[model samples]
Target: MNNDVVVIGAGPAGMAAAIQASSLGLKALVLDEQPAPGGQRFRAIEQRYRRLRAAGKGLPASEQKGLDLIRRFRESDTRFVDQASVWDISPGGRQISYLHHGRSFTIPANAVVAAPGAYERPVPLEGWHLPGVMSAGAAQTMLKMSGHPVKGRIVLLGCGPLLLLTARQLSNAGANVVGLLQTTGPADFLRATPYLPAALRSATLLKQGLQLLTQTPLVPKVFSLTQASIIGADHVEGVNYRSRGGSGFIECDAVLLHFGVIPNTQLSRLAGVAHDWNEQQECWQPVVDAWQETSAENLMVAGDGGGILGDEAAEMSGRLSILRIAHRLGRISDQSLSKLAAPLQRGLKRLAAARALIDTIFHTPETMLIPSGDTVVCRCEEVTAAEIAAANASGASGLRHLKVQTRVGMGPCRAQMCSMAAMAMITPGIRCGQRPPPPATVRAPIRPLTIGQLAEADVEI
Candidate 1:
């Protein structure tokens, strides 16, 4: 189907983009992998909101805001397809390919907004492959979608606001939170002090973060963690950790890990969009302009897919990205676009002021980024850190070379889970003024699909 714009997510950014596109008199089609709207940050908000309301309970402030956005999206004239997994976008952003209901379809669009969002940065440690060891985001997803806490004694480890938030959520959900382990310490906070003034500009966010820290369950907490390993053979038994204060082991059935989040750049890269390494966030993100338009003519990346901006900023950036598309399509005049974009730009600037401090304070520990010995860096391929190190030592120059040498990123997940860690291992140090290696190459069939499914794809050429 032909449309003015196709939005490739249903999160805050995607929803906001579609809503803005419709307001500008443009037909927008939003394709999202979730069964409903509200991306990971607000996963299953609608269903949970309804259930809680019926039970005479109210949703969290953040979730209620997400539900409000979802309601607006549902009320808009823009069309949306849920449970649609977009696997490819033609170069130059002219066509979209997605799988829905076990069938593949290609559609033409004038412009595409990629808001694939972010995923938790993987922290590869010993025995992390054990069952019941998952990312904090995964645990949060379980809590949000099903209102069920993860079973048994749990140890929440790693850094980032999400770690604390997930711990609080799980604790409130009646999970047996045995311990909280933080990789960040006083040194990181000291490093972040320079950015505190800017962060203070968003007092509401600071207050919320403080609340999360103080209101979390009173459990044994360890800070300045240098290393962690799951002490399990088949399933999670406990977590062995080392911190500045001391080293200890926490008996737990589940270990939830979180370091931070990185942009989901697979689709953007597949579309041949140029990306640059964000030194601050220590991840590769699609290069976008002030308006969120990528190097490709009509493709834009919004929200965390472009970079790890929070959900509120994602919504603002999403609206900002569509303003340019709407203007280019003649749906809005120059003056109209300028007027419409002014407030969103202001909001984005305000939200971004705090990101520096957040990134600094929660920077992924160096040890976790480049694990050594038998730690499995690539879970899908079972590639260990020593294998990657050995390959790099044997002349694996970059991501491509490493992939060829050791198959570190050729797994079913297509480097999504392992690329960052592998890159960390391959390039342990970079000389000053030297450009870091480009991200792994992205190709079609970004998501796995059967050969028969590809052959039966409905083409709209």
Candidate 2:
């Protein structure tokens, strides 16, 4: 009972989980790599949005929700370790092992919650390695958080709710949104609409998209997106494409391209938790039951790390996980269990409805974003997209063979920069392995420390 209950990530979902655990009178420790908590989402909102909110912070509903989240974490009691990157997780001799502080140690937590949120999945395409192309999520964060807006007349590529919405945000923020690429045709609504019955829970999401399109009718259309390749010698100067109906090039300085996100399951895979391929979402998610318990009873997963359930659902899931943890520890009576679950279950239902609508209009990666014959698939190792094609050309198809043929996945960054590109080259039907980041390779401290600092650290702490 006297062990650290570690929560990875301090994003909205992880924050909610930590607060719930502490409120239940449990000892918990949160580990995050960032100097500040608030994963990328609220972290970005904290920027210009905060200045805008300072005028009438509580007025705008969206900005207000963001503000409230920041205030809550600021007031929580969970112990936080910033700049502490959790590199690996494994079953620790009846406990869980965490590689932190550049050392491997295990904590005996009766419970553990993995709340690692989502990261932008790799966007593979022809000439995607050209300097000017980047994922929409990365561009958004750079502007919102770092105050470095992705400049120039940007061609916002990829199709999904995210792409459209991001275009609006960029346009609002004064970037020239030259083109909004659509991977799916208008017939996509017809082809995928049949899934709507199962997806109607997300009506608010569908409404939101309709509203955005209504507000800004000038969004750019597909600028030669079918099997298109961005062309440039050292930087992306333009995109050339031949759709079924048309062919042309859309010149641009930058291209903000991205599909939907995959689960940030690096730790889950490293921990050897059971995972299954979800073709639809195109990423691995942890296997959890009704209570968010993983295949291993002591381990639990919550939030987008659990799967792509959106933020509100993630908050509710965190609360639900806490309830289950309390119940398992006998902190609550059986009679009270029913009373607790009813409202929580109802809330999840509403979130489910909202999620359905989002799934429909959300971005789906077009073949243009995936690798083609001429593209250099690996950017970090500088493996040309053509070499990957040469391998695939000879029936040396699939990501494994592609990797074997070209040493794309063997660099120091260790596939972090190349795995998704390989997958993008292959068909969706092929199997892919989780490219979990190897433990942080520590280096000498920035400021050369004297024996005095080490001796002082030992003496003081």
Candidate 3:
């Protein structure tokens, strides 16, 4: 029940941290919600490769590095608990309570690494709640894990690297990609020229971006789209988008929307870690030191969960966190830690520069951030944009007031689905100078558990 360290998540960051910690002689246990490791980026990679190879499909270069990382992680002595849903962590990051195999257990730990990754920023649009509509990341998960191709013609809407990557992955998987609609244009990339050198410093990342941009099979890709809407009732029938050429419609079976990704900060928030908003990324992030330690002693957060950096940065952050933890445990010398931290610090700076460029190039379009008056913002509560606007007009101050008056964030998702949109409506101009507000309060039982399961809990203090 006791360990030197407990790492939450099995993604690149978590795996890297746990492997490093274990190799340093720390008793590290890695817990992940997925039945397999690799997180979303490498979701079910091993099984997917086997299935694809059996079907005469070769592994895509996009997934090669991740596969190698996962392989190395698996070879490590780190203990892994797959499908372990961590619900809460005790004060000071000493213990964690998680549900595994229908049982609850509280494991004590000296240090905790929270590597919960990021999720797509939910962009609301007309008819977005209809069937056949999903986040672009979800579509990629389906394809990556089970080789489940999207049924019928699909339209990819919105911006970010994920959209382009998903489009390419789907097309390569034989899905009929109807269209690729982007909210940002060449102007956005041109605007990011000053940061281009930093972004291009990593040849691998530059090559990946080039491949995704050029490899998509969809033709006539539209850019600078505005007033994009999903036109369907019970199911997705088609998509409506506007550009300089005026409005147009694309008949498709489904619409995959993704503006960008925001860190998954619920767990860190629940752990009472101090967080601040990243104005450029427009998301909440845990306040971490250069060593990746959070304000709460012994608690570390890495990966996209801490911010919106890409996988490479996440891996480096994870290693940096583990190195710090290892040094704290006397597993590594101070001199060694200092030497190790230097390179990670440099890598993080380069990555930060690159991320700034990426964020600018694919900044979530203002139109997407602020949905139309009639658009459904909170799909779970069936709350519309007008309703939230009415609440704000009636003197609602911020996300808390809006949530109380309009029940916008009280749904099953607990604000994950609608918090960003509601916050945007309240603060129309979110910039750096403005003091960033903390995220909504996160209570215990972060993930839903049945009443009966809770009653049967066997967690020890």
Query: Local error of candidate 1 at 451, Å?
Result: 2.1
Residues 187-306 of candidate 3 have per-residue lDDT tens digits of 888998998888888777778777877887755588888778888877999998887557899999999999989999988888887888788888888899998899998899999999
Error of 1 at 294 (Å): 0.3
The C-alpha lDDT values of all candidates are: 0.89, 0.66, 0.86
Candidate 2 residue lDDT tens string, 16-89: 87787777776677877776767776665555565676776433465557557766766777787777655445
- Residue 100 displacement (Å), model 3: 0.6
TM-score of every prediction relative to native: 0.98, 0.83, 0.96
Identify the superior model by TM-score, candidate 1 or candidate 3. 1
- Score residue 35 of candidate 3 by CA lDDT: 95
Locate the minimum summed-lDDT window of 10 residues in model 1: 426-435
Put down candidate 1 lDDT per residue, 1-461, tens digits, no spaces.
Answer: 67889999999999999999888788899999989999998898888888898999998787789989999999999999999999888887889999999999988878899999999998788999999899999999998888899999999999999999999989888999999999888999899999999889888888887897678789999989998999988899999989889999989999999999999988989898889988888889999988999998879999999998799899999999889987887878889888988988887787787889899988777777788999998888888989988888888889898888878888888888888888777676632334668988989988878898889999987
Candidate 2, residue 33: Cα displacement in angstroms equals 1.8
Off by over 4 Å in 1: 430-434
**Ranked by TM-score, top first:** 1, 3, 2
